[model samples]
Target: MLSIIVAVAENNVIGKDNGLIWKLPRDMKHFKETTTGHYIIMGRKTFESNGRPLPNRTNVIITRDKNYKAEGCVIVHSLEDAIKEAKNDSEAFIIGGGVIYDLSMPLVDRIYLTKIRHTFEGDTLFPELNMDNWNITEKRDFEPDEKNEYPFTILTLDKKK
Candidate 1:
């Protein structure tokens, strides 16, 4: 199953200046726990934002740069090739920069979305998805605390059959 793993603000903002705009340790923990063993596909910018490969997961970066190279990552020119690279994984994750998320939206089977209750100014935005075609199979809400900035909800949505 190809799933999208992302965190978006109320205004659909995901990042600004090539980095995330908020701090949410809880959300980060959740992300790590969920995607640890899976193949993670992301855009070149997303991979750069992270600085290095995430341990314990295969990092596949989709980029148009034919000569792009990340020491520990699999660099592919397109999303289709990224998916093909991880064909053996029963569940691979589409981690992202906005463009990658937008491109993968139609092909992913499920989404693990972290919906922050507040809005923010950002240069990148997650593509708006039509809720009618998805079913929320799992959900959990969290309140802001010392480590997490905003109240948010994490939803696991499965594409309706």
Candidate 2:
């Protein structure tokens, strides 16, 4: 199954200037815990933003240009190719910047969301999730930490069909 792991602010902001907005340590921990052993797919820009590959996971980056390549990352020209590569894995994670999330949402089976209670001014956002098509299977609220500017909630949703 395909899973999308994202941390979103109250207004749905996921990033700004190709970087993450919030520095929630717990949320970061959640991300690492959930995607550690999975195949993680992201856009070329997202890969660049990180400066390096995340450890303990297979990093696949999607780019339109066939010539583009990054060290230790599998580069593909389309989402179809990425999915094909991850087909044998029990779960493949769509970890992203805006464009990748928008493109991969429809093909995913579940989502792990960290929803911050504060809105941030940002240039990028998480894709709009269709509530009707997803069922919230788990939810847990977390108190604001020194690193996080406001309260947040962790939610896990599975596709209805």
Candidate 3:
């Protein structure tokens, strides 16, 4: 299964200056839980923002630079090549940065979204999802705590038949 995992605000913002806008630790933990041990495909910028390869998972970085390399991660020239590398995995995750998210949106079979309740001013935004093409398979709301600034909902969407 190909899946897209991201946290989006009410305005569809996902990042600012190549970094995440929110500082929700719970959301981060959820992300780690979902993508751990899966093939994670992301663009170069996203990989850089993460600082290092995620542990216990296959990190596939998609970059146009033929000579680009990141230690402990697989570098691929295109999204297709990244997907091909992940073909044998039971589930591969498309982790973000806007461009990769947009390109993978149509190709993913599932979406694991953390829907933040507030809007944020951000340069990067997630592609608008068409509800007609997806069905919510699961949903759980989280109330804001001392550690988290905003209330959020985790929604799992499956491609509609």
TM-scores of all models?
A: 0.98, 0.96, 0.98
Q: List the residue pairs that clash in candidate 2.
A: none
Query: Which 10-residue window in model 3 sums to the lowest lDDT?
Result: 14-23
Q: Candidate 2, residue 84: CA error in Å?
A: 0.7
Show pairs that collide, candidate 1: none
- Model 1 misses residue 14 by how many Å? 0.3
lDDT of each: 0.95, 0.90, 0.95
How accurate locally is residue 160 in candidate 3, as Cα lDDT from 0 to 100?
91
> Residue-wise lDDT of candidate 3 within 1-161, one digit each (tens)?
89999999999999999898789999989999998989999999999999999999999999999999899999999999999999999999999889999999989999999999999999999999999999999999999999998999999999997
Regions more than 4 Å wrong, model 2: none
* lDDT tens digits by residue: candidate 1, 59-91: 999988999989988999999999999999999
The parts of candidate 1 lying over 4 Å away from their true place are: none
Residue 93 shift from truth in candidate 1, angstroms: 0.5
Candidate 2 shows a clash count of 0
Q: lDDT tens digits, residues 93-152, model 2?
A: 999979989988988899998889889999998878879999999999999767766789
Models, CA RMSD each: 0.7, 1.0, 0.6
Worst 10 residues of 2 by lDDT: 143-152
Q: How far is 82's C-alpha from truth in model 1 (Å)?
A: 0.4
**Clash pairs (backbone) in predicted model 3:** none
Error (Å) of candidate 1 at residue 126 is 0.6
Tell me how candidate 3 scores on lDDT.
Answer: 0.95
